[model samples]
Target: MISGPLDHFRSGYVAIVGLPNVGKSTLLNRLLSTHLAAVAPRPQTTRHRILGILNGPGFQAVFLDTPGLLQPKYALQQQMKRQIDLALKDADLVMLVLDASRPDPDRGQVPPMLSGRKVLAVLNKVDLVRDKSSLLSEVDRLNKEGAAEVFMVSALRGGGVEQLKAGVAALLPEGQAFYPPDAVADRPEKFFAAEFVREAVFNLYGEEIPYSTAVVVDEFKERPGRKDYILVTIYIERESQKAILIGRGGMAMKRAGSMARRQIEAFLGRPVYLELRVKVAEAWRNDIRFIRENVYGSDRPSGTA
Candidate 1:
């Protein structure tokens, strides 16, 4: 159980896990009241664990937003899945976010993998449902899954968030504040830039294009007065993929850059001049070198930044 002053305590990590498109990113953003994580309408929009920090007078809670759970399609995917594994290793709490608007065949079932952890089943998107009784029944069903607690919340509307925050704070183990009271997140600036670019790609393109692509920020430099300058390369698996990203007279690229720049500016709270270049890495997702150099590079982006 949490150990610290009732109103002034510091804390540990909480892992938010769920299926793709279940509103994990939305929840994180609301909790932090900041755009620390990129939000896209696409499934698997989050490909890495982004940290969102909550600071109080005497407490701090660090939340880790993990990629959606799915079967690995390549080495990159397998690596992404590993982020969830790492989160489960020593988490102070695990939040299993399930969509209440949809039925889960495994709804009431708890995997043995979580047998020893403190688990909370969050029935998300409650506002989307028409009947509260049915939602309650679903909650009851999940209660049988070994979750220590249950919370029905609509991440989009900020419903029940205060209660959820209070509950989470109550569960924190006693310790010095893990981070400064004002720290909203732990990620480097470049990571957000990369994610912003990727989110743009996801929204601009349909189907395999979003999933098949990756973005790496090669340069992020401070400019005199115009704006913060960013240069990023969009990596794709094949040359044919390159054409799709570039488009005729670079219309597609222009759309992606423009869309992404707005979000980047919002996230950074400054004008951003985002420059994007498309390249073909020839199946980088499956190539070890590609994954090593890009996805899991030594300067790997982490919320713990």
Candidate 2:
């Protein structure tokens, strides 16, 4: 046991987990006060374990924003599950973020591999619940299920977020900081470039296009007096998909590249020359080896910044 008041500093990993489309990424972005994780209206938008380090006055809470836990349907999904498992194994505490707007989502059950760990139930999207009584009932239900604590907040609107942050700090074990104050994420800008491009793909197309796509930053070069050069490839499962992405005379690919470049500029606070290409990788989603080495290269694409 920690004995002295001087050892009051707290630092630990908090795994933020939930079912698909529960606003886990939104909550991560809200907590970090930055867009470190990718967010979209679609399920399974986050395919990696994105870290958000919140260095506060007395404590440092490293938040691991994981992909939604679900049954693995393909190699990509299986890898996503592996990422979640990694986070769960490393977590000092588990924040089970659930959507308050969803019907009967307050199960309050402990997630897999989280046995005997401190779990704080975050009933997010409270703003969507017009009936306050039902929300209270959800809280009461969680209490009955032996939750460590239940925090209500709207991650998108910033309601009740500060209180939740403080509550999280109090539960973390006392230790020194793991990361410096200036650092907000564990990933490089090129990693986010790939993610932002994928997000743009999600935003642009419908049906099976987004799911069949994987983005890789093939190259990133900084110029002393010119726009930074970024070369990216959008890997699709079929030639037909590539045709759709490229569109008439490459207009579609140009549009996605332009959209992603603007987002990357905003994120990096600098201009970039983005080069986008689409390639056909047949059944790559089912190829676990390719997914591991190429797409998720050390949590980023291979040979990239």
Candidate 3:
């Protein structure tokens, strides 16, 4: 998958699709060498299709980070699934990342989204698999099932990533760059601001709450040569859950805010003043109006992004 000498620019979208907890975000981050997508050790942490762009000499890989395909329980989950489908429809190439460390899928069974489109099966987290021979066999099995290629890589340990990158680049269609070479992502600062806070919530909170929660950046203002101030609201469904997020003496909320703010500052390349507040939305996941207001608004902000 090496580039040729009489080089031409290769730029196209590559969709990263997989089941839950398969390190799709981590893989995209490693590929781009940037924390453009939020990474957490929780299932379905990515709620929308996030784009992480990798621009190199003669190439720009716009890797789309899609939510894990799963059964929908609420309107929000349905939207997430729709995002995945849309990504598949638009991608020039598809990287189907599967957790090599996890329990094997039943023989002859396949992921539902394997229906149409050209895909490269990537066996991710290979470092976690103890039996190397078994892992190779699994990869070979996937290659037989319509994948144009199969790659084994550890997204965390940086194992076999170069090969994966080259494979992805080779699969992309020949075209002009969709975005500028310097652009790492298409998302605005506020989107990452909310996602960074959500990542902290996933890391700190227990089951159900993290999945139920969503963050909205209410206000973001910056003064030249001065610090930035950002106000964000953490949304949940129940009052008790809101109390849990706040914790005793606001300790939990403070910790989450502090951790997220540090990451935000690093991302912004300046000091940041972050303010977080929690509110109960009473089944926002099921409410289409609420989804239209907060989740949809935050995810698809107007203008170029």
Q: After superposing candidate 1, which stretches have Cα over 4 Å from the reference?
A: 1-10, 298-305
Q: Which lDDT value does model 1 have at 285? A: 77
lDDT of 3 by residue, 1-305 (tens): 55443156677788898888899999998998777778888898998788878876567888889999789988999988988877777688888888888785642224656756688888888898888788766766776777888888999988999888777777777778888777888788999999999999998899789978989999999978878999999999998897889999999999999999988988888899999988999988999888878886855542223
Over 1-305, each residue of candidate 2 has an lDDT whose tens digit, in order, gives: 12223348899999999898889999999998887788888988998888889987688999999889899999899988988888887889999888888885435455655657788889988899898677787778766665688889999999989888888888899898988988888788889999999989988888899999989999999989999999998999998888899989989888888989888998899999999988888989999877987678856432111
lDDT of 1 by residue, 14-118 (tens): 898888898999999988888778778889888777778898556678898988888998888888788888777647988888888888777555556777788
What residue pairs clash in candidate 3, if any at all? none
lDDT of 1: 0.81
lDDT of 2 at 171: 85
> Candidate 2 — which pairs collide?
none
Each candidate's clash count: 4, 0, 0
Choose the strongest candidate by lDDT. 2
Instruction: List the candidate numbers ranked by lDDT, top first.
Output: 2, 3, 1
Local error of candidate 1 at residue 28 (angstroms): 0.7
Q: Where does candidate 1 clash, by residue pair?
A: 2-172, 3-174, 9-58, 9-59
Cα error, residue 108 of model 3, in Å, equals: 8.6
